[model samples]
Target: MASSHPNVVTLHRVFDSPTDPYVYIVLEYCPDGDLFSMVIDSERYLMPPEPYVQDRSRTDGCPVPESPEYVEERVKLDNLIKTVYDQILSAIEYCHSLGLYHRDIKPENILCSADGQRVYLADFGLATGERYSTDFGCGSSFYMSPECQDGAGRRLTQYSTAANDVWSLGIILITLVCARNPWKEAVLTDDTFREYAKNPDFLLDILPISRALNDVLKRVFCIDEEKRCTVSELRASIRGVPRLTASNYETWERLLQRGLLKASRPKEHAQVPVEKNTFSNPDTNSSPSPSPVHSPPNASWDYGPKQGKFGQGLGPFAPTSSDDSWRILEKGRPR
Candidate 1:
């Protein structure tokens, strides 16, 4: 289901050996590695990598080279951060539309393309569907939400996975913009997050990010799940960035849907011999060629049409129609 979203790592195919208990899941290979490396690089340079930079020529539909100009680099870097954030939120919103939620959303699980134009949300092993519910904590401590943390050995209370994901997104945004984590962990008991939760202006004092972005972060890190912005709301909040347009999102969505349709089609069957112990090896490689597998009903995994909000046509968040609508929403937000 997630493979259909361009911001998600594609799952080429999954094959199981009848002779062994192991299953082989083929996935897309990203040349640029994961977002953790990108975060480190951003910190080193205090900006986005050259490949990901967006200069003014970006508005004229041209890619700019890595410039020696510092002011130009900083402007490009800010646009790049907003662009990445838009995709991240879109990926999460798409997952929610599928009734799925990613429990782990830290930088380590996010992958950037070699050219750095694309970022994918990877590592769904910790993700869960809406049907799941639990009081136990999960995911990395650094990005966990206040509710996900047990207060100094106290039992964790039941919490919404969707809301927990929003908290992680908040942490990720801070890491991307500030090039450093605001807190070691997000827990009400932790002095860092607790102070921020009480007064989010603390973020602005440390980092010189815009008030618009800070407002978004404050709602994302809100201690009360009821107050935290939903993925839909997050999309609306970030969509108002002047340089980050909606067309990029619509283009990726259309391309991903086409790819998903191709991948979802049932494949032709073929057999290849494999040794018994080979399945036990973690690094074992399979044939590069595609093979046939049973494709589930499109209704079960399809997320585009049913999950849209406005109407049957991409819902309320549809890129074409909702761009201006979202702009109006931004006007109503607190400064």
Candidate 2:
């Protein structure tokens, strides 16, 4: 999945060893926590103290940041929940744009950044799309899309279109606000999972989400392949809340425009910009690590005070920082 969409998760390095399970993976860590945890700890997240446009603090009473005791909680639960959906939509769209389908799209598997800038769709253990395929279904029965659960009994072909991923995304979106699986009620049999897949609309309508969001889910969660949305279509459809899309052209432009903006930014300020750090050629080194610079959001910061690190990245050895001994401050602390 990282190969397809680097922003999905920052894969630090790929290692291979002749150890048990054949050590082969690119590891990473999420600074914050998963979406489920964020929701479960609802009291901890307050809206900005000031208006959201200019600042990013909580609006209600300007509660202490993440302070369990001072948080204002929210009067309306819908906005925070919608944020989760919005973030997931952004990640899912990035994957789909790469011709990939995150066969897995459940909340537990989705991780949030420490800064809350984005959500990541992790565990591509069973993911597939364009140049990839797996015999196993990637997500829990509760979130499986229709195509992933029907036919030939647990076989991969049962429901394996890009739309299948959208179906699972729909279930996740509903769960964001409702906080429980809606299908849990209708799905009674042992194959309750299968039963849920049998009727997505009936399951969705049960929650009473905003009419606009509901409409988007209606299309993505459609049981029939012909009516359902593919990764690209699903992304464009949900570009705006309460409104699927302004029109086809508008949707494509937004998607394209985002891609253009991301590509145009200077490489280093990628990965959904935090603050920013510039790397001189010396830090690049020999080996092949995808410098933190590849992800796209890094280029938007004021350049200077570039940080240095010991690393061997993708291109031939090159100096990474101006100073011979410069260390990046990781959070705080001189590195």
Per-model lDDT: 0.58, 0.46
TM-score winner among the candidates?
Answer: 1
Scored by Cα lDDT, where does model 2 land?
Answer: 0.46
Per residue, candidate 1 scores C-alpha lDDT tens digits across 144-171 of 7777776433455577888888888887
Error of 1 at 109 (Å): 0.4
Q: How well is each residue in 163-263 modelled by candidate 2, as lDDT tens digits? A: 66777777666545433344421123424344446654333223324456666776875656557776556566655674221222222233345453222
| Cα TM-score per model | 0.61, 0.51
lDDT of 2 at 214: 63
TM-score of 2: 0.51
Residue 119 displacement in candidate 1 (angstroms): 1.0
